[model samples]
Target: MILDIYKDAFEYSAKNLVTLFVLGIFCLFSFLLIPIFLITGYNYRVINTAVHGVINGKDPLPDFDDLISMFIDGLKVVIVQIPYLLVPFVIFVIFGIISGQLTGILSNAIMIIGCLITLAAIIAACLMSQMGICHMAYNDGSFSKAFALSEIKEVIDEIGWSQCIATYLGLIIITLVISFVVTLIIAIIFAIFGVSGAALGADAGGIFGLGLVINSLVSMFIVGPYLSIFNSRSVGLLYTMQI
Candidate 1:
C-alpha cells in the first residue's frame, strides 16, 4: 500500500514538467514569502484532488490560475501549520531560558529534560500536522478542521498508528538520504573543479564561492520543489486510507 502511494505520487508529480518547473520558480523566490504561499496552496490543491478523486480523465495536478485564490488557500495552510510548529519552538525557548538561570548539575539536568521534552513535542507536532493538513483539505479548506484534535486522533487511529508511524519515518529517511546524496554529489563536483582545495589561491577561493552559490540555487530551485511535491502527494494519498 505504501509502495502504491509513492508510485502514484511519482507519476502524479512527473506528469507535467512545465508545472514542476513553475513550482520550482516559486520555490526559488520562497525567501520572498509570497511565493511560499503559492507553493503551499498548490499542495493543498494536490491533497484536495487526491481526496475527491480526479475527474474527467484529466490530470489531477492543479494549474497556477487564480493567483489570488491560491494565495488565500496558501495563507490558510500556513495558519494551520503555525501553531503546531510554534508550540514546539516556544517550549524549546522556554526551556532554554529556564535552563540558563541555573548552574552546575541542576542546570545540566534541567537542560537535558528540556531538550527531551522539546524533542518529543517536535515529533508529536510533525505527526499531527501532516494529518491536520489533510483534514483541512478534506473538509473543503475549513481552517478549524485542521486543529480538530479529536478527529485527527480518530483518523490516525482508523489509518492505524503503526502504519502512520512507519510511513512518516520512511519519508524522513528518504528525505535524509536524498539530501545526503545531493550534498555529496555537489561536494564531489566542487572537488573535481579544485574548489575543495581553496587554500591554494585566491582564484580557487573565488571558484569555491561560485560553487557554493550554484549549489544553493540547485537545492532551492530544483531539488526543493520536487521533494515538496512528492511529499505532499504522498501525504494526500496516505490520508486516503482513512477515507
Candidate 2:
C-alpha cells in the first residue's frame, strides 16, 4: 500500500524547486551517465535546506549565493572522500570532447562499445553511491561506514546477485514507463494545438530522449524519497522473511 506521506514528496519538491533547478544545472553539467549523480546530490542538499527552512517556517529560494555556498560545501565534503571529484568539474567537458574526437575516428559500433564500458562503470558507481548513502541515512551507519570495503561488500552480498540485477532492471522499466506516460500526455496536448509534437519536440521520439531526462528528474522529485527511505525497510522485511 502507498504511504500517506507520498503527497509530501511533491510539496517537498515544490518548496525547493529553485534548489532542485540549481542542482539540476550542476548535474546536467557533470555527466558520464546523464545527471543522475548531480540529481541525487542536489536532492540531499535540497532536503537538508528545505527541511531546515520549513522547520523554522520560512520561504526557500536557493539563488546564486545560496547555490554557490552549497556547491563549495559539497565540494569540501566530496574532496574529503573522493578527492578526484573536486579537481575541476571542467574535466568532464574536456574529457567528453576528447572522447568524441576519438569516437569520430572509430566506427559507430566500436565507439558505442567503448562508451558502453564507461557507461557501465558510471552506472555502477552512481548506484553504489546511492545505496551506500541510503544505508548511512536509514541504517544509521556512519558517513564513512560505507567506505569500509567489507561493510560495503556485505550490503552488496545481502542483495543476491540475481535479485540485485532484477532490481536494477526494474528501475530501468519504471523509469521508462514514467517517461513514456509523460511523453504521451504531453504529445497529445501539443497535437490538439495543431503543433506536431516533433516540431514542438514532444513527439514520441523527441520526447523519449527528453522524457528520460524529465522522468529522471520527476522520479527524483516524486519517487526517490520513498526509495531512499524504504530501501532498507524493504531489505529488512526480506531478511525477516528468510529467518
Candidate 3:
C-alpha cells in the first residue's frame, strides 16, 4: 500500500508537473518584459489558483484566471503584507543563536531544539499564507480568514508534516542537483580552453544562481502538479486515517 502510495504520488507528480509548467511558461513569457511580472503581479495569483485547483481536482483554468485577477486586485494588499513575513524570519534568526548554543552546551541539543522551533515558526508563517491564498482560491474565502490563526490545523493536517517538508526539501534538492550538474559540465568545457568558468564571463556560479531563481518557478512547473494530485489523495487518506 505504501509502495502504491509512493508510485501514485510520483506518477501523479509527473503528469501535473508538465501541464503546470507549460501553462506557467506560456503566461510568464507572455508578460515577461512588462513591469507587472516584477511584482509577480498577476502571474503569482494565476499560478497559485491553478496549482490549488489542480490539486483539488477542480478546473485549473478558473483558478488560473482567478489568480490573474487576484493579482490585480490585491496589489495594494500585497505591498502592505509582504514585509510582515520578515518578522517571523527575524524571529527565526534570533532563535537560531539559541539553537546554535546547543552545540557547546549540550552537544547541540538545545541549539537543535531552538533551530527546530525557529524552523517550525517559519514554516507556520509560510503555511498560513499558503492556506490563506489557497482557501481564497478554492472557496472565495476572505484573506483575513485565510490568514487567521484558526485555519492552520486544517492546512497541516490535510497536507501532513512529512509531505510539506518533503515537498519543499525535494524541490530544493532537485534544483540544486540540476544546477550543480549543469555548472560542472559547463566548467569542464571552459577548463579545456584553459579558462576558469567563474573568472571568465562564462560563470557557472552566476548561471547556477540565476537557475536557482528560475528553477524555483520551474519546480512549480515540474513538481507542483504532482503535489496537487498527491494532496488530493492525501485528503482521502486523511479521512481514512481518521476513521
Candidate 4:
C-alpha cells in the first residue's frame, strides 16, 4: 500500500514536466505571496482529484489554468493550517518565558521537559494539520470542514492512528534522506569549486555569496516544488484509504 502511494505520487508528479517546471517557477517567486497560494491551491487540487479518482481523459495532475479559484482555495488551506501550528508555537513561547525566569537545576529540568512537550506538540500538530487539509479537500474545499475536529478524528479512527503516524513519519524520513543527500552533493560541488573556502579569502567573498545564491535557487526552484507535490499527492492518496 505504501509503495503504491509513493509510486502513484511519483508518476503523478512527473507526468507533466512543463507543469512541474511552472510550479517550481512559482515556488521561486513565492515571496510575492500569491505564488505560494497558487502552489497551495494546486496541492488542494491534487487532493481533490485523487479523492474523486481521475476521470477518463482528465489529467491526474491538475493544471495551473484557474489562478483566481486556486488563490482562494490556497487561502482556505493556509487558514486551516494556522491554528493547528499555533498550538505548538504557543507552547514553545510559554516554556521560553518560564525557563527565562528560573535558574539552576529546576530551570534546566523545566527547560528539558518543555522541549520534549513542545516536540510532541509539534508532531501532533503536523499529523492533525495533514488530516485537516485532506478533510478540506475531501469536502470540496470547505473551510469549515478542515476544522471539523470530530470528523477529522473520525477519519483518523477509520484509518487507524498507528497507520497514520507511520505514514507521516515515513514521509518525513524520506524527505530528510533526500534533503541530506542533496545538501551533501551541493556542499561537495561548492568545495571542489573553492566556494566553500571562499569565505577565508578577502577577495573571494563574492564567490561565497554566489554559491549561496545558487544553492538557494536550486532549493527553491527544484527540490521545493518536487517535494511539495510528492508529499501532497502521497497524502491525498493516503486519504483515499478512509473512503
Candidate 5:
C-alpha cells in the first residue's frame, strides 16, 4: 500500500508537473504562509479524494483544479489545526509560570518533566492531526469532523496504532533523506557557480547569495510539493484501508 501510494503520487506529479510548479512558486513567496496553507489544504483534498477512491476499490489521484475551493478548504484546515497545535504551547506556558517560583533541583525536575510532557503532546498532536486532516477530507470537508475523537480513534484502530506510527516515522525518514539530497545538490551547484564567478572577477558573495535564493526556490517549488503529494497519498491510503 505504501509503495503504491508513492507510485501514484509520482505518476500524478509527472502528469501535472506545470500545476505543481506553479503551486511551488506560490509557496516560495510565502505570503505569510497563507499560500502554504492553501496548497496544503489542496493536498488534503487530494488525499480525501484518494481515500474515497481506495474505499470504492478504485484508486485515483485527484486533479489539481478548483483553486478557490481548495483555498477555502485550506482555510478550514487551519481552523481545525490551530487548537491542537496550541496544546504544547499551552503546556509550556503553564510550566513556565510555575518554574519561576521554584529553585535548584526542584526547578530542574519541573523543567525536565515539562519538556517531556511537551514533547509527548507534540508527537501525539502530529500523529492525530494527520488522521484528523484525513477525517476532514473523508467527511466532505466538514471541519467539525476532524475534531470527532471517536471517528479518529476508529480509523487509528483500523490502521493499528503501531503500524500507523511506523508508517509515519518511515515517511519522516524518507523526507529527511530527500531534503538532504536536494539541499546537497543545490549547495554544489551554488559552489560551482560561485567559484566560476570569482574567477571571472564577479562578486563571490553576491553569487553565493543568489545561489541561496535559487536554492530556496528550487526546494520550495519542487521538493515541497512532491513531498506533500506523496504524504497526502500515503495518509489517504492508510485511512482507506480501515473504511
Candidate 6:
C-alpha cells in the first residue's frame, strides 16, 4: 500500500510535469505579487482532489486550471486553520503569565511543564489542522465541518490508530530522506564549483553564496509540489479506508 502511494504520486507528477512545473514556479515566487494566495489555493485544491479521490476510490492529481476558486478555497482553509496555528502561541502566553508568580524549584518545574505542554499543543495543532482541512474538503469547504470531532473520530476509527500513525510517520521519514538527499547533492555540486572557482582565481565566495540561493530555489521547485501531492494522497488514502 505504501509503495503504491508513492508510485501513484510519482506517476501523477510525471503525467503532469508541465502543470507541476507551473505550480512549482508560482510557489517559488510566493513572496511576489500576492502569489502566496495562489499557491495556497492550489494547495487547497490538491487536498480537495485528494479527498475526492478517497471518496471515489481512485487517486488522481487535481488539475491546475481554476485559479480563482482555488484561491478562495485556500483562503477558507487558512480561516479554518487559524486557531490551530495560534495554539502554540497561546500556550506560551499562558505559561508566561504564570511563570513570574513562581520561584526556585517551583519556577523550574513550571518552566519544564510549560515547555512540554507547549510542544504537545503544537503537535496537536498540526495533527488537528491536517484532519480539519481534510474534513472541510470532504464537506465541500464548510468551515464547521473541520471542527466536527465526532466525525473526525469516526474516520480515524475506521482507518485504525496504528495505520494512521504509521502513515504519518512514514511520510515524515520520506520527507526527511528527500530533504537530506537534495541538500547533500546541492552541497556537493556547490563544493565542486567552489573549488573550481577558487582555482581559477575568481570570486569563490560570491560563487558559493550565489549557489546557496540558487540551490534553495531549485530544491523548492523540485520538491514542493511533489511533497504536497504526496502528503495529500497519503491522507486521502487513509480517509478512503473508512469507506
Give me the candidate number with maximum TM-score.
5
lDDT of 4 by residue, 52-170 (tens): 66312244678788699999988888888899999999998898889989999888888888999999999889888988988888887778888899998998899888888888888
Give stretches of model 3 more than 4 Å off. 1-39, 46-52, 55-84, 90-116, 193-243
- Locate the minimum summed-lDDT window of 10 residues in model 3: 234-243
Report the error of model 6 at residue 93, Å.
2.0
How far does residue 237 in candidate 6 sit from its true spot (Å)?
2.1
Worst 10 residues of 5 by lDDT: 54-63
lDDT scores in order: 0.81, 0.44, 0.48, 0.81, 0.78, 0.74
Candidate 6 residue spans exceeding 4 A from truth: 1-7, 10-14, 54-58, 200-202
**Clashes in model 6: which pairs?**
none
Per-residue lDDT for 51-100 in model 1, tens only? 66632224467888999999999999888888999988999889889989
Clashes of 2: 0
lDDT of 4: 0.81
lDDT (tens digit, per residue) of candidate 6 on 1-243: 656666665565555666667777888687784567776677777777766774334545677676888778777777777888798989888887788788888887887889899987776676677777888888888889888978877777777767776777788888889878887888788888999999999888888898788777766776776776667666665666676
2 against 4, candidate with superior TM-score:
4
Question: Model 1, which residues run further than 4 Å from truth?
Answer: 54-59, 193-210
TM-score of each: 0.84, 0.42, 0.49, 0.84, 0.85, 0.85
Model 6 weakest 10-residue run by lDDT: 54-63
RMSD of each: 3.6, 10.8, 8.1, 4.0, 2.8, 2.8
Backbone clash count for every predicted candidate, in the order shown: 0, 0, 7, 0, 0, 0
**How does residue 97 of candidate 4 score in lDDT?**
88
Report how far residue 32 has shifted in candidate 6, in Å: 4.3
Estimate, for each residue in 34-71, the C-alpha lDDT of model 5 and write its tens digit.
67667876777777877777633444455567777877
